[model samples]
Target: MVLQRLLLALINRAQLVERLAESKAIRRAAQLTAFAVIKGRLAGKQASARLRDSDTARMMREEARRMPQSAADAAQTVSRIRNTFMKEVKEGMREANRQIKDRK
Candidate 1:
């Protein structure tokens, strides 16, 4: 009973804080910050994708493994390589963003 009452009090306090934060000034400031961060992220994804390492060692290994190494096979391998690379880069960027946000 005591614990339940304490939890309810904490929940009520949290709701009060949320309501206070919904004021016009706070909302506008949050909106502006959200827009700026989103713009930065879009730009970052583009720039990061462009600067991605085309010379990834795993790509080379997979290319070397392609036995007949026909043009079609090479193209497929390249596509696979790019997909893997992009997944890695995006994961890294996500971690970086998380760390940056946590720091702030």
Candidate 2:
């Protein structure tokens, strides 16, 4: 009985904290200093899509399995990974921008 009561109290405290954290003033104060808006839909299903479909992830796994033959190969690998990742980020940002425009 005592343990159950303690658990209930903890749950209530968590709920209260969540509510407080979502308050407009608190949220405004907690705004990300970087490009949070451009980081759209990156949790859950979206993250799964990134892992399964992103060229960057595929190339990373492929690169990890093999050693680079030379300095140029390593440099090329890095450049390809950078380009693939930037392309995805750009697409995500564009999607986010489109969503914002749709909302308005």
Estimate candidate 1's RMSD in Å. Answer: 10.4
Task: List the candidates' TM-scores in order.
Answer: 0.41, 0.56
lDDT of 1 by residue, 46-99 (tens): 867755644465566757876745888768877887888888788879988998
What C-alpha lDDT values do all the predictions have?
0.79, 0.85
Span of ten consecutive residues with least summed lDDT in model 1: 50-59
lDDT of residue 64 for candidate 1: 81
List candidate 2 segments past 4 Å from native: 1-43
Candidate 1 wrongly placed segments (more than 4 Å): 1-56, 65-68
| lDDT (tens digit, per residue) of candidate 2 on 1-104 | 99999878876897787987889977876686334654654466678976798888898999999999999999999999999999989998999999999999
Q: Candidate 2: what lDDT?
A: 0.85
